[model samples]
Target: MSVTQEEDDPFPVDVSLFTDTFCQETVYRLVGQELKIRQVFGANLGVAAPVWDAALFLCHYLGEQSVELSGKRVIELGAGTGVVGILAARLGAVVTLTDLPSVLPQLADNVSANIPSVGWPTAHPTILPLAWGQDHQNFPSEWDLVLCADIIYLPETYPLLLQSLTHLCKSGALVYLSSKMRKEHKTHDFFEEFLQSRFHVELVNCDHGQNIHIYKASLRKDL
Candidate 1:
């Protein structure tokens, strides 16, 4: 998981049409046993792009949607390549792809080029600058779900990241968090802090190889 060793995943990865063996219907393959995503070069403002854990989390999301996400608001915190939010919007959620200000242009460009334009008719994805820990009253609220991937690598940012998660999610809203078990002790620390937060977290099995953990969380207390 030395992301520094590889350049950003080539942009415009195809959103494939996949059908599980048991179900013949085509589902946009956001997550599954086998996963793929389309992403152009990152903003390169620090770093931008999907890492290993992001891929695994997204794969799990594919089969978990029991209801249509149309009109549902989703905010992908730390939306590096904007792929997660893009997949959500592509599924008909009104999505906000939030990241640092420096990452917005690249994310916005990816959204426009891959998904529907921001100004178009139906559910579309847009970008907002949201630094973790800062107030985000302007970011979408009452969101049906919050999606995050690979943002827990830095220990110092854990507090801010959890704080942002609490602020953006409405009561009972679902959150999909995927992180790598790179540093076991640090990972435990994050979960320890996470348990003290307002959300309830549960572990789930994933097809991605070991070292990746996918947790589905929801607000534990009224927001």
Candidate 2:
């Protein structure tokens, strides 16, 4: 699939779907609004192209919690497909959807399609490139809420992810992290050991069938 980049185009498709690439769309209704997401599948896209189960679960969780989103400064780390961040924007939060540099175009496309300029007046989601540990310092630490979903599968990234989270939550930002309990990846160990050591972690929600866990954490200022 070749993406058209015409400036006048309402929805400029930036995704180039090769013979090996495939696409799927999912429409989710949350907080009385509908969000259409495009999930791309390809060998080189890594884990940042598809909308994960944890991301969907977090959307529902946020809606159910009815957390005050209006005017809140929100940042979503590893914002794959921009579903959670877009939903946050729809709920009236000033949201920044971020991921690796390679994933920004697709993330931007999803954000543009869902949160268009005309209908949405207050909240417009911003797309940016954020590589966890390395780029955390480049961003300010004044966000009201920080979000992460299904981004804990890789063991090598644990320390880096922690580093980023620690820096982002430095100014008392609340962190909402959703993860699938993958034993092979030792996901539980990250929460029990590394994360707990640095932050105050609480398991807020869980999907028993999917083995997904949603945690609410804050930086341990005492440390």
Candidate 3:
């Protein structure tokens, strides 16, 4: 997992020479692009978060549809490794990578590494420390899109995640989310109720045998 400093490396090397002790390096392919990712963090109160398969599936769909990502201001909530948000940035969106304060450094590193060198966005993507359900006075008032992946595992976080999404999203903004439907009924029920309250939700696609689902929803009205 350790990345060595090489004089020929194109991207800036801000991460330390040593890899995170608790996390392992993994690779994924999105829209025919290979990306290196970190997995299983000991930090964040021992949460083992990674970019899940559903996220890759969603990314593929976005690519296939030629989604108009250019010049869009995007925010990613609970961005574990910041892959989806980073990909959006690579595709020309102005992305802000966000996670818990403790995890921002690693998330930033991963973003810096995987983002393409060709036609980089004029405004480099930012890494910010944020916790869901908390006050967000310091964050951007609105975003064109709010992207999240694999954040629906915990029952307690469902309400907070929805509240955060509702707070940061602009009027008529799209919210993209991906998750592997868990066994808990509360997770499903939370999404059903939350979508009913403020969004028009639709299932974009689902990967069979993996339980992965991608969804697209738009805010119902200006708050």
Per TM-score, the best of the predicted structures is: 2
Model 2 CA deviation exceeding 4 Å by range: 1-19, 116-118
lDDT of 2 by residue, 22-74 (tens): 78888888777788888777644557777889988998999899878888999
- lDDT of each structure? 0.61, 0.84, 0.71
Q: Report the lDDT tens digits of candidate 1 across residue range 1-223.
A: 1123224222221223211111111223453212133333322344454344554456455447454566777788878767667766766678888887656766766666564434433566777888777756666557788877777666666777777777676545688777776674387677657644677778764545666777788777643
Q: What value does the lDDT take at residue 160 in candidate 1?
A: 72
- Give the clash count for each candidate: 5, 0, 0
- With candidate 1 superimposed using the best TM-score fit, by how many Å does residue 193's alpha carbon deviate from the native? 2.8
Against the true structure, candidate 3 reaches a TM-score of: 0.81
The parts of candidate 1 lying over 4 Å away from their true place are 1-43, 50-53, 64-68, 116-121
TM-score per candidate, in order? 0.72, 0.88, 0.81
In candidate 3, which residue pairs get closer than 3 Å at backbone N, Cα or C atoms, i.e. clash? none
Instruction: Tell me the lDDT of candidate 1.
Output: 0.61
